[model samples]
Target: MKRSSDRTIKWLILLTPTVTIGLWEYTRHAFLLPYLSMELGNFLAPFIVLAVTLTLVLGLFRRLEQSQRALRRQQAATASLEERESLARELHDGIAQSLFLLAVKLDQLDRTAQDEAVKELSGQLRETVREVHDDVRQAIANLQQPPSPASDAWVVPLRELLGDTAGVLEAKAEFRWTIPESRLTGKEKVELHACLREALINVRKHARASRVYVVGESEEGGGFRCSVEDDGVGFDGDPMKAKERFGLKMIRDRAAKIGWTFSAERRGELTVVELRKAGADA
Candidate 1:
């Protein structure tokens, strides 16, 4: 039914201009031709009116087309972002928290171990549990982070998100953010926050190192770059193949939604995730 309606609308759109042009041509040749009078400007009157009206109508149509295109783009971006947020929440609230509890139990078991063999096993188990705990904690933090507000009212506080993420991993996660003193628009802030969160989450889950660095810097060209880097068990193969994981898909979707460029790669033992805002050449 919807398709049929759309088809009808399309046919009407296609026919309206044709019909109008045919009527104008007919009127010019049949009605106005016999009454042509150059001295009184009567001969040019119908032509002049038709030209003006056509110009106005065409201009209006162009504006409407542009508006519709903009609306569609915005809607698509919004839907993609929402989907990413939902996936992030599910990972954080369900998988990550559960793993964190398991890690706590493993810590308790480690402290209660007395025998040498049991102690050695418990120590290994504790390390594994800690790793899992850190991963989950990072996921939760990323998932729970609030989207940036829509007004130019305030910027999403990057310091808070960074601090919380660092605490979760118990690692030396340092942040260096440099934005203009002026506040960011709500949409810009939200996109930046989402990109940063995904990058940090990737670092926590994939990088096994004790140190991570996150930086956000606005470029001179009115765009920004956010990067996350860590020395960990980086993948040996293609970055695209590595990112085939579910979490990476969410990150990609979020970046695409915001019209940002996302790239991930391993340098030596370090994994780096970078997101660049679209501006100019972006």
Candidate 2:
């Protein structure tokens, strides 16, 4: 509607001078010719036309400015809401995942409580608690930090997560990032990081891989593709049997939720999990 109004305003601006001139000419020749002399009317016509034309043009331009300002405010509000959602996802991936891992460790300790040495169990429990505390502190710090515009703002934390996962699995991990242009939106970045984190965790828990390789690259047409490849024994049964594995289901659900393509397959000696956004390859 604003665009249509802008077009109409432009046309009106163009016609303002013409309409004013025509009205002045009509009044001077037909209505006021007897009352006012032709010489005086001719002298006054240009000034009258200029005044009316300025008034109409200025008023239309002011309205256009007001419309543009309103549009800008709306866009800013949308962006702010998206940023908040991104922050929420970040918190989920960070603090929530840490708590889940802590729970798993505690469950493991409980199961082995009858068999394991008391000293060893106590040590593991303390370490797990410390790790959880650190994660919570880091998450709070991240929440308080101002938003960053840097393209690689997500890189550092993702690398750290992969490294930590590799340590847990006692496997070698390597990451290659070839994102020449980081044009990902806030939601896309959050989903991408979460997907990669889930992939590494899956590898750590299930894949008996000695080495893992993660790659993020620009795709051909215009989009991005990230793959987690491991030289591990791949899934033996149907990969899509979601009921059997909760982690795979979570990863797939997140990708689907965010409108990204996700696939996991065994390619010879390597199992690969890939995520791709539709138009971010460039």
Candidate 3:
């Protein structure tokens, strides 16, 4: 809307002088020549044309300026809303879920007094800590993904990406996306694509896995997350080899720049690389 209005105003400004002079000449020859001498009419033409053109140009330019200001305000408001949504997704998907799981584990501890039960509770506690740690790492890796508008229709582009990157690995590749295209901004989409591409590249070069799966989902009225899962040698079972690789470090760095969470993990039997986006950004 703003662009269209500015263009219209510009055209009107250019045409103003031409139209005003034409009208003045028509009046002089067809009606006013009888009252005004030819010399006087000719002399007044430039000044009259200048006055009319100036008035119209000033008015049209003012309207253009006003429209531009309104468009800027609208864009600012949209960006702020996105920031808040991103923050909300972080809290809801990461910290909140972790805390709730901890609470459940504590409740189980309270009900059992046996030493064996106590030991089991200790294991559960340890597992929960590991889960949180894994979540953090994955969050860092996911944020680096480039995003499109939050729309489900973005599946084709992602599918093409998977085919171009993961397909050549001679593995059976599967892809799914449920997140709406309206959920992410254009910049987010770009960053996310970069991260996913890197993750897939890493899988092809190192994972030595047979199956690769990519999935994206938006929570019910909440945040969105996408993960790349593979049957490669899982990272959790092998501690010495689990240190962050350079590719993952690059991914984490990219994620940090945009405030999203991206992570790659190898569990007991599966390797997963995920990117998570909150509902908005702060």
Candidate 4:
């Protein structure tokens, strides 16, 4: 929708003046020459075209932008609903079932376990209940979050994703964005969005941090960079070599494919994932 609107505006900008000029000249020479002078017509034609552009073409451009914005919001809202349903299904089918099994086994153990095994079984039951309790709390937090509004600015989705991740992790999420609208290409935005989402997923599953900070900026010399920093216990080992960390690998591969530099490392007390795109000339 956005692309079509943009293309229509571009065509209007390019063709409107040329078509108007051709018709003006044709009418002046073929029909109006006896009535209107060449120099006077020439002087009036530019103002006439400008007036038409300011009124007709610009009006259409604004209208198209408005329509596109409306369509995008509707799409976002639909996707949000679908995602919420999927999350609810996951909680019910996956976590809820596991919790039910744990509760059942704990009940049987409590009823029949001998004194010697009681300590171990009790510890196991406690651990299972704690895990289930945490999972339920997180799920409830996620389901209770209000949806954010959609808009042309990329920050809406960015903020929404961060908020959701924060709710799931029960972490404090902070981010600062300074990348100007014109600084990023559409491809850059897509890559950044996916990478950041993966990075936040890693934080949720692995970081166990109380605070997560995501920073994005348009650097000097046209460069763009973003960093996801978490005050979590740093990776147990090299994040790239961790057995279950396909997310880190995927982020690296994606950044490489997109010609951006990616890094995950412990910086002071924070585990940081940084992705950087070089200046255009570089």
Candidate 5:
């Protein structure tokens, strides 16, 4: 439609002067030769035609420039989609495959273990590896999905994640969140979610807790913290022993990378894992 309209407008622009000139010549010869001379009409007619043509040419140039800009924007969007897909493929083929292989190895260990403790440990390792494999695959799936124009509220995805964990871990879970919307940035939300995921996984695998309570609350000033507490067979001997655990180490490293504080400890009969960051705006 736009192209057709442009063609019609261009033809009208070009034909208007031709039609006017023909009418002027015919009228001058037939009715107004005494008043209007041929030389004056001919000379003035060229100027009028030149001015109209220049105006139309400038308008056409502006439209063409806009069309080019639209084309470039479309090309950029296509390139971005291709890049995202390529990254997803790399993750699936690389990290995802490696995780699957590790899970297989753990399964083999579980089968070949001589003692009950080793067999149980191997079984737990296999479960953890499978969970990590699911997480990586989910990340790749998210990448494959089209990017949203705006970020979502933090609680939305966080709630869904916790709900899934509860079902998978077969534990009763309660989530109470009161942190403000402005509390977490996009990157901060990712780190916080990762930490929470690891904490919940720990509850499922190690804590043996039947009930889990998760609370997110604002701190003094503008900082915020989230705690995952469980009435489990709390941490063993030393909190520092968590350094040897993969899930704890992963969450702690994620928090450290984001300059947030992460800690896991025993409080009475409940095991508590907390992740927090102080806001710069405070």
Candidate 6:
């Protein structure tokens, strides 16, 4: 009911000026024009008023459009954030808990297995389970929150995450970071670090490469570019097909969410992942 009333009011408001102007013009022509000439002032006055009134209406329309756009953007951002939170909760409550239970089962098997080989297999299973658990926990933790605001010293934390990943993979990883030693906003650092981690994880899982190299440098524009390269048995399938893998999907989503360009391709025997931050050329 209120909305109907508001709509009616808007229509009335819009038509009132037009009706008044028409009525005044008709009245002036029929009554006043016999005694008074339609001089320049008399001719221009109604048009000037109409112009001012139309200008105000147009301005109001523009403001309404802007407000609607802003509201849509805010709603989209809120929905995205809620989805991430739900994903994190599911991972923690479902996959993570399942892995823990599997670890416990392996522990029990270790005690009951009679053959030495069976015992060794159980130990390996336990270790694998633990590694999986850790990886899932890290992924959940990373996705649970938004990126911190941009800061001057972003690369430091990224370097740490990379170093940790290298240790976890037990692979030889080298960093060629060139970001300036300035404080980066929290948001910038988190995104940069996430990109680097995704690249390294891909290398560790699929590349089967012994050595990995991470290079970070200032892009020609304002932002930066980071590349991870590994000399491994490169995949032969289409890159899009490979994205069916959850890890690759997550990497792509994270890059896109942060307004970064992400590409992965196999160059001969080397699998390379590149990330580019956009709109930095201020």
Score candidate 4 by lDDT. Answer: 0.80
Per-residue accuracy of model 6 over 91-193 as CA lDDT, tens digit each:
9999999999999899889999899999998999899999999999998997787633221245556556656667766667777876543323467677767
Select the stronger candidate by lDDT from 1 and 2: 2
Local accuracy of candidate 1 as per-residue lDDT tens digits, 164-186: 66677777777666754332456
lDDT of 3 by residue, 1-282 (tens): 678878888899888889888999999999998899999999999999889867778878877887786777667656856765686578668776776677677667756656877867777876776677577655544443433433234467667767765667777888877765555679877887778777777777778778888788886534788787889865644432456666666777888898768776765678888877665332
Candidate 5 lDDT, 58-126, residue by residue in tens: 676666665565566567767877898999999999999999889888888877889999998888888
- Candidate 4, residues 153-204: lDDT per residue as tens digits? 6766877787887888898988777775556779888888899988888888
Instruction: Note the Cα lDDT for every prediction shown.
Output: 0.66, 0.77, 0.73, 0.80, 0.77, 0.72
Q: How big is the RMSD of model 6?
A: 14.4
Compute the lDDT of residue 242 as modeled in candidate 2.
46
Q: TM-score of every model?
A: 0.41, 0.45, 0.41, 0.46, 0.43, 0.42
Best by TM-score: 4
Predict model 6's lDDT versus the native: 0.72
Off by over 4 Å in 4: 1-152, 280-282
The runs of at least 3 residues in candidate 5 whose Cα sits more than 4 Å from the true structure, single-residue gaps closed, are 1-153, 242-244, 279-282
Candidate no. 5 TM-score: 0.43
The collision pairs in model 5 are none
